[model samples]
Target: MERVPLSEVVSDCVRRWFQDSLKEAKAGDVAMQVLVGQMYHSGYGVARSEQKGRAWFEKASRYRSSVWKVSNKRPGLNASDSDSDEVKENIK
Candidate 1:
């Protein structure tokens, strides 16, 4: 899939989405953390900071790990798992 350019992202909406998803009642969703990481990484809907990006990416990894440990779980339908090392090397 083609990625949406960082410059065009709606920062406010992304912020709102992340905040709302963090609420206790809405905490069931796991993708929010990943989206937050992506926003930080690309500065699409947030300020650009590699430290922040890494932090969020770590959070995403943790979320994925948790799911994997539960009920034989894996990435969900909308989850954006990273490509394999082989695929990444090929693209370089």
Candidate 2:
């Protein structure tokens, strides 16, 4: 029997979670799109790309009324002006 490090297991789980979110986002799930945006912004399981993140954020915002307010922070990414505005609007 072999043992995997805790960090490895956690990373793999995070990766799969983000992958599932990506699929949901592609299926037009507004909340999942926002989640995918956050993942991209933070590089949780994918490479961080502010451009791609912003695009997803904007797409998700179009359905803002359908999405619930989650959090206002992206762990490893700085919030841009638009990002702040989006969060504010979503919170409202």
Candidate 3:
């Protein structure tokens, strides 16, 4: 799971950020889900888990779709216009 590098150590701040983002993600925040996904995929803080990352991404996609279906407006993505593609970029 050495996605970043063997020598690169995760900082405490990054770990805290991951924890906070994970909490928000669990609370139904799509943005947080993507962020947490990125963190997991990159091993920025928590242990690397591409499977967990993809799971979070799928959750975000499903949630976003439901939100759009209900309101006729997609959730505004801050990083990019496309959520799936943007979220996918990090994993690859």
* lDDT (Cα, tens digit) per residue for candidate 1, span 7-85: 5566566666545644521364457655555555556545666676556546656657532222212212223343343
Q: Which predicted model would earn the best TM-score?
A: 2
lDDT of 3 by residue, 1-92 (tens): 54765344447667788899899999998878777776776676789887887787778767564322212122223223455664688999
Judge candidate 1 at residue 54 and give its lDDT.
Answer: 58
Give all candidates' CA lDDT scores. Answer: 0.49, 0.71, 0.65
How close is every model to the real structure, measured as TM-score? 0.45, 0.72, 0.61
Query: Cα lDDT of model 1 overall?
Result: 0.49
Return the TM-score for candidate 3, rounded to 2 decimals. 0.61
Ranking by lDDT: 2, 3, 1
Query: Residue-wise lDDT of candidate 2 within 1-92, one digit each (tens)?
Result: 89999999999988998889899889998767878888887787888887877788788777674322332455323223346767788999
TM-score of 2: 0.72
Measured with C-alpha atoms, the lDDT of residue 52 in candidate 2 is 78
Look at candidate 1 and give me any clashing residue pairs.
none
Candidate 1 runs further than 4 Å off: 1-15, 18-28, 65-92
